[model samples]
Structures are given as C-alpha cells and as structure tokens.
Target: MFRTEISMLAACALAGAAHGQNLADLSLDQLSRIEVTSVGKRLQRVADVAGSVYVITADDIRRCGATTLPEVLRLAPNLQVARVDGAQYAISARTGTDLLANKMLVLVDGRTVYSPLFSGVFWEAIEMPLDDIERIEVLSGSGGTLYGSNAFHGVINIVTRSAGETAGTLVKGAVGTSERFVTLRHGAASDAGAFRVFAKKRDAENTQRASGAPVRDASRHQLAGFRWDGGTPQRQFTGTGEVYHHRTEDVLGERDYHGAYVLGRYIEDAGGRRTQLQAYADRLVRERSRTIRNTVDTLDLELQQQQLPTAGMDLLWGAGWRLYRDDAQPASPAALDLLPRRKYLHLWNAFAQVEMEGAAASRFTLGLKAEHNAYTGLELLPTLRYSWRPSEDSNVWAAASRVVRTPARVDRDVASPPLVPNPSVRAEKADIAELGWRGRFGSGASASLTAFAHRFGQLRSFDLNGATGVFANNYGGWLRGLEGWAEWFPAQNLRLKAGMLLQHPRYDAAAGTSPQPPSVTLGNDARHLFKLGVAWDVRHNVWVDFHVRHVGRRPAPAVPSYLAADARVAWRPAPSVELSAAVRNLGEPRHVEWGAPATASLVPRSLLLQFVWWP
Candidate 1:
C-alpha cells in the first residue's frame, strides 16, 4: 500500500509540473490579508489578530478530499482529532479529546450547534453540503468574553458561500472500500437575490474491535437544505433551513435521530457603523432500542452592533437569549434516566468590547460578558489583550483571561443508580495567559507561534459521599503548552505547511484527598504532536496533496502513539467535470485513537474514488 501511494504521488507530481500554468488562487501575502470575523466579533486580517488562530480555505478543503466536516478539521494543526469509530470522532483544541468534549464551541454561519443536554456538538447531526463551504476559522483559545459559557477552551466557525456564488447545478458521488455517498445541489438567480437547494445521502460500514470482532457501528444519513441571499451590501438579508435524519447501530442496540432548523439574519451598515440581528428555531429527536429516547426544541435570538465610537477607538456589544424544552424517556426501568422527564433550560448573556489604538502602532482591547443559566444564576467572564505591530508583516500579542464552563443538564440531572446527581454543582473555572507572534516573510512564507498557560479550579470529579457516588467539584490543575504552524510556497505551484504542539499538565486533589483517576483524566492529553502537508497544483487542471501526522502517547487510559499519512490526486478533464482518487491511513491497516485497547474500535485504512460535475 505504501509503495503504491508513493508511485501515484510521484507520477502526479511530475505530470503536474510538466503542465503547470498558474499559481494557486491566493499567494502567501494574500492569505495573510484574508479577513476573518471570529477572533473579535468583527472583520480583521489574520496577521492582526491577538490570538492563536488557523484558517482553512476552500482550496485546501477541495484538495484534501475530505467529505465530512470532521475530516476537514484535521487539516488545522491547532486541533486534536481522533476517529473513534466508523461514524464518530473526538475533536478538541488545546485540551483533551473525548466523545463528548464540551469545552469547544462550534458555529455554522454564526448559528450555535452545541447541544444543551450535553453542552457538546452532535457531529452526526451536522450534515451540510461541503461544496458550499467558503472557509473555516479555528481559534484554539478561550472565547468566553464574547461567545459565553461553553466557549471555554476554543471555537470553530464554519462559513458557507452565498447562493449567488453557487448559481448552477452540482452533482457529487464517492465510493470507497468502506463507505459511499451522493449529493445534489441546484441554484438559480432572481431579480431580488439568488437561492439554492441541496440534498445528500451517505452510508458507512462498521468498524472492528481489537479482537477483529465487528463493533456494529455502521451508520446512514440523509439531509436536505436550502438558502437564500437578498438585499444590498449596506442592508443585507439572508435565510436558511435544513432537515436531516441519521441512523446507527451500536453494541447495545440501534438508534435513529432526526432534526430540523430555520435561521434568519439581517445586517445594516451605515458608514463606519454596523448593526446585525439574527434568530433561529430548531427541533431534535432521538429514538433508541436501548438507552434513552429524547426530544429537544430550541429558540434563539441575538443582536449585535459595531461602531467607531471615537478616533482610533472601536466598540462592539451584543446580547442574546436562548431557551430549550427537553423531554426524555428511558427504554427500560433499569436504564439511565434524567429526572423530571420534562425540563426547560434558559440562557441569557450580554457582552461588550472596546479596542483603542495606542502610540507606535500598538493596540489594547478589553472585553467582558455577564451570563445567566438555569443551573448557574450569573457569572462574569473577562479578557484583556494587547498587540504591537513592529513591522508591516509582523505582530506581537499577549492576553489574559478568566472564563468558566457552565453546568450541562447531564451534570446535574442524571438519576440513575451508582451515579447521584448534584444540583448544587458549580461551574468549572480557568484563568489563562498567552503570548504569541505572527509574521509574513515576503510572499513565499508565513508563520505563527503561541505559548499559553491555564490554571484550572473547581474541576468536576466523582466523590464518594458516604456510600453514594456523587459528581462534585474537588479537583484542580494547570496546563501549559506551545503551538505553532508555518506555511511556505516553495514554488509557484507547490505549497508546504508544517505545525507542532508540546504541552505539560499537572493535577492534584483540593487538599487532603488523594488524586483520583477521574481528576487526572481531565487532562488526558498527548505530550506532543506534529503535522506536515504538501499541496502541488502540478498543472492548471491537475493537483497532488499529501498529509502526515504524528501523535505522542496519551496517559491515564493509555492510547499508544502513532503516525498516519493520507494522499490524494485529482484532475479536471473538462470545464465542468473532475475526478479524484485518495487513500487514508496509508501503511497502517488499523489503529485505535480512544478508549481502552481491548474495547476500542479500530479505524481501518480505505481507498476511494470520487467524481464531481457542474452542469
């Protein structure tokens, strides 16, 4: 398998070089100038942000041959991504990875997608057409001051293209050793605006346990969505809706899940001031042969404004409200259950940020947020940041922040035996400090580096109160890490990217108690990680890409260190047709990224062929 992949890569690279015509869409300098809106809730250049961030462009996603959002996220070096099974993944930034990682916040076109029940994203429920994605901005640091609560560790914002940009018909199909999928999209232009509708279906085979026994984790998914873009630049309006269904098999039984959502937004820009309002409603349902069955309905509304309040000063403020009504039922009397079968959860938050320019191209920013939740009445989050531009292509930044991870329904409502709920549970807290630098070396290279230290308190731990095992806050710890990535344009048509991360963490009991596995597990992390990637647009219509990653061993549960590689070759035979072949997990037939080795599911190697057409 390794030899075959290498031969294919060699041939593609030679062919592309012989037929090369133009450089990739954007140059190194142009990439630095790309505007992003997640760092500070306002548009800013990548080189100007005072945080640790990485941007994955549309071209990068296309060349990587990743059919799903989770797969695409692996391209960002700032994140730790693990394939748990055939249809499940564990992803986190600057923290431990888990099946239900709640520290990271995810947004699709500015709409929150995290679940209220677990305070984590259901990756299986997010089934959007990948072809419409414009870009993804990944920030590997706390965003609580502006995003609030669950935005404790990091944030991922997915931006999609407008209807006008996809005004045509598109069809895509892919078949692999273990999976198959098909998608269709159609768009049209109108006097008022443009509109598009799309649908997709996918099926995946089951993964296997260490003993070669099938895990029965196969899955199927179907999704449909529509979007409309209207109005002018100064006063724009947009609306979107989506419906999806997914089914999967587990060791215990089979499960079916479905959901639908609709969202609308209006933005007005007057001179140097901007105002935006958005609203959305969503419903989700789950049915299972075992475990629990549940339904959740959500309503959310938000308003924000940005203005140049004075000379060399900018102001940004926002407010939001969200409500969730959840109903749950257990499959059996002995199964786990949430008390008060029916419950309502409400969240309210308001935030403000001020940025002022100082002497010698320096800038200072202060932000604060006050948030209230059903479990925790009110909490305050604050951040202070400063940046100095020593040159046109270099920036030095530092920041200090205090944030908290509010309790989720699962944290305080479980009413099953062997596990007792604690309604008085307090929020987990963190105090962080960071120093970073970003620089562009001419048009051929660019780089970013950041060092961070986080002090944690009131961490969740399992406590034996008399005879009952109650969830409690009895642990504390500290984490310090260094992360950085660099990009180089070795040639007009060839680009190379490399990144690395190194960290050290320590944990202990609050005082007299001994350290528990649950407390140490809070920072179950890899000591170091490294990644390298190559993208060569050999020709005007041919491309070759390769990615290699190395993860150090993890403690506690003990996940062995491993190195993996992926390669892809694509060619456009005509103006409207393209074909690609890719291989994942090259050389390594199977490996486990999470769970105990004896019970962990193995991720298998796969070879795939894909076709895309625009007619």
Candidate 2:
C-alpha cells in the first residue's frame, strides 16, 4: 500500500527527530524561515527579497501529499505543470512564452485567477484548501511595477491565512492506489473575530491508456471564511467565500463543472501608512455537450500611502471595474451568435512607487502603470527597479516592465468546431527585462538567480473560420528564458531545495511558412527543467520528506520527458493525535507535457493515509 505509507512517515520523523534538542524544541531545520509574498507588495524575508522569489508552506502542503492543485504546483521548479483532461490543468511560468497571454498572473484569495474567457486559467476551477494554505508566493519575472495586467510570465500570489491562524477543529482522511481523499477544517476565536471553514472530497480511477479515452476522475471542494484582525494588527477587515465542483472524462461524455466566489478585504495601517480594499463575485457553469456559462463581477479598489509623511517613498493606486457574462448555449440553433460572446470588461489602473536610498548600500525603484482595457482602450505600463546591497548578505536587482495581454472570449468570440471571432483584436504587448541576485550565506540558507528577456508584440494564432469554423489567433510569436533557484540548511536537521529552467521560443515571421502541426513552438514552452527537494527532521513526532522532479526534452510540437519521485512521513502521536503517509509516482517513469490528450498518460503510483485531530 504505497510502501506502507512511506514506511509510516519514516517512523514518525524519526520519533520526532529524537527530541531535536530537549528542553524546548526547534528542530525541523530550526523552525525554518525565509517567507515570501511574491516580491514587492509586502511580506519580505527571503534574504530581504530583491526579486526572484518562491515559497510554499502549510508544512509544504502536508509533507507533499499533493492531491491536486497540479500536485502542489509541481513543487515549483520554475513551474510548468500539465495535465489537459479530466479536470484540465496547464500551469506555466518562464517560457514557451505564454501563448497569447500565458505570461502568468494568478491570485486566489486576492481574486484575479486568469480567464477573461481564455486568457486561460481553469485549473479545474481552483479548489485550493490544501490545508487552508498560508503561503505560495512564486514570483519569477515582471509584475508590471506591482501587478498590473498579465504580469508577463511570473507572479503567483496565493495567500491564505488568518482565521486566527487556524484556531481549532480539524479532520483529515485519505486513500491510495490512484487517489481518494477526505478533508475538513474549522477554526474559531472570540471578541467578534476569527473564523475558518474548509472541505474537500475527491475520487480517483486513473489508469486508462486510451481506449476511446477515459479517466472518469471525480472532484469536490469547499471553503468559508471570516476574520477581524480588528484594527491594530495594522487595521483590518476580511471576508471570503468559495465553492467549486469538478467532473472529468471529456469527448461526448463527462465535462461538468461548477464555481462560486465571494471576497471582501480591507486593511489599513496608520503609523506606517497603508490602506487597501478589494471586492469580488464570480460564477461559472459548464456541462457536457456544449453548455457553458460564465459570470464575473469584480470591483478591485485600492489605496496606498506608505513612508508617507516620512521615510523614502512609496505609493500604490488602483481602480477596477469588471463585469463579464457568457451564455454560450450550443445545441445547434443555427448557432445563435455561435454562442460564447459577452463583454462588459472594464479596467483602469494607476500605480506609483518610488524608494530611493542613495549612496552607501544604494536602492532605487521608480514605478508607473496606467491601464484602460475593454479591448485595447488605453495603456501605459512602466516600471524600473534598481537595487545594490553590496554587502549585508549581498543583493542586486534589476527590472524593467510594460505588460499587457487582454482579449479572450476566444479572442473576441469563439464557436467551438474550429475557432472563431476576432473583434478586430489587438491586445498583446510585452517588453520585459529582469536581473536578480539575492543571498544569505553564513550557513543560514537562501539563494536566488534570475534572468529574463521578453519582447513580444501582438501575438495570437489560429485562423480560417468558415468552411467548418476556425478562428483564434491568426499567428504571432517570440519568447525567451532562463531561471535558477536554491535553498539549503546544510546541517541542523536538513532542508534543501533546488531549481533550474531554460527555454527558447519563436516563429515571428507572421508564422506563415505553411502548416502541418505548427502552433509555433507548440502549446507554450518547457525546454529544460530540474528540481530537487529534501526535508528531514526524522525524529520526534516524526517527519520525513523527499522530492525529485525533472522534465525536459522537446521538439517543434512534441513533448515527452520524465522523472518523478516523492515521499513523505509525519506523526504526532499525541496532543490531538496526527499521522501521515505519502508516496507519489515513486520511480513511476514515463512523462509528457502540455495537456488535452487525456492528460497524455504516464501517471501511476499514488497513495495517502492521513489522520488528524485537534485540541
């Protein structure tokens, strides 16, 4: 049974790392550190965060039992997840250069999760409850001077915490051999503040090497929220609500979905000057055989005042209004407007950031972003970053930005069959540059390395709409890449992490040159990748972990590259009881990338056994 749940979580992390060091506690690599918030926009520490960041917590998603969310986002190795069927998923970061808007930019607790009707991001309608998340700040490239428009290839901020930091009431369950699960979480606090709720259910039936294609996977998710850091935790007011549903097995059968969203946030900081507010509402519906419905209502309100009447300089501005609707009824009624078409998207953005601390350690950051979109209305995204810490653990940062990618609904309107619509489209822009260097040696662990170059202009592909339909992005392309990462704790119970990525993409000659299977560089890129992980402790209440991933190998439009390994263990024994077991694709070779062909096979090995109870 998956190696007996990874040998009973390695005998409960070596019986709690043999008391790590009596008289108190502090094992697990000395309680670990180096948090993140995807660089710029707050939450630092990753060696002071000068760029290129990464953080995934919640105890690394329960020691990596992964169960979805693209397997905990493929444990970030510069990200590049694929599985295009059965609840679809296709995450990207770094290269293949975000086909017509791949340029990453996602948010869950902060709203904004792709989809303007195909800017894409339906990662199975996001259920995120991976233990009520509390971190996930992956930021590799541009953020348009602080998140403004399709971030241009890097920015993943999925933050969720506060419920008084998981008050109480918890439960967990699991099954293996292809996958099965159960989850629940609850929390509470008094003084009119703090609350939490979570739920999860999943079913599995993997293994279907094709025979008319079938995987029939099942999925379910739920979440609830409430918070009242109540003025003083730097002023606050937060609210959240989420709902999701899933169904798999496509082609004439399974293809169901359900979605719901609600969000409200307000945070204010007086002495340090900081203010913010956000609003959201989303609804989605999809069913088998051509029934699609989408609704979006968002009001992102922002206001910032920092280092205000003092310090160096900093300011943030915002204004948003998005209202989208999609009916898409297609049972063939002369194809009424051929379905899929509803527009009411509006956006207006304002940004400003200036932090200059000249001489000595040097520091300079000037930012600006102005946007107006409703299908290319107005735009001006600008930003520049400069840093030079020279010493104090080293630091060096460089940045340049201007990004945009708007126009979905199949780029204006799609009608299945082949593709359609092109409402005079024009919304594809990229001009990016980034350089990074972050450090923290002295055996404390921390490292970073970044390199980027983007220069795109109006890129989209697919055409010829009548004779049976077809129309999407009549062609355009160009991309580039390079990435690096590191983390180490040398001794003290271990803690290691590593990453690497390199890519190249093209076909800008208007993509003419005839066709045969040309989508230029094919469905985003995945050049070369490498990832490694190790987390020990192996003693005291137990804890054991290991991860290894490698995905590389490509041609014009064919992907096949593999390597996988995962293992986990955890045990608490008392004090509310806790137990864990994990094993995923351990040595289960065969791999492929880019989704949709029933997720392109090769996913075997799976197991999980969990139990939790709280005080």
Worst 10 residues of 2 by lDDT: 1-10
Cα lDDT of model 2 by residue, 164-214, tens digit: 667777777777776666777777777767777777777666455434454
What does candidate 1's lDDT look like per residue over 1-615, in tens digits? 000011232223222321222346457666776666777987777889999989887677777878888999999998988888777887889785777887889998888888877788878667778888767889888889989888888889888877876788989999999889999999998879989999999988998988999998899999999989888867888899999999988777877889999999988878887888999999999777778888999999999999956899999999999999989898774658888778999999999999999999999999999999989899999999999999999999999998888888787887677777789888999998999999988879999999999998987776765656666778888989999999999888888999998888776678866435752336467788999999888788888999999988878678999998999998889978889999998968988787778898987889889999988
Report how far off residue 509 is in candidate 2 (Å).
37
Supply the global lDDT for candidate 1. 0.83
Candidate 2 whole-model C-alpha lDDT, 0 to 1: 0.63
Off by over 4 Å in 2: 1-49, 52-54, 57-59, 63-66, 70-117, 125-137, 140-149, 152-154, 157-287, 292-383, 390-400, 409-411, 415-422, 428-539, 542-578, 581-615
Q: What's the C-alpha lDDT at position 127 in model 2?
A: 61
- Per-model CA lDDT versus the true structure: 0.83, 0.63
Task: Estimate TM-scores for all models.
Answer: 0.95, 0.32
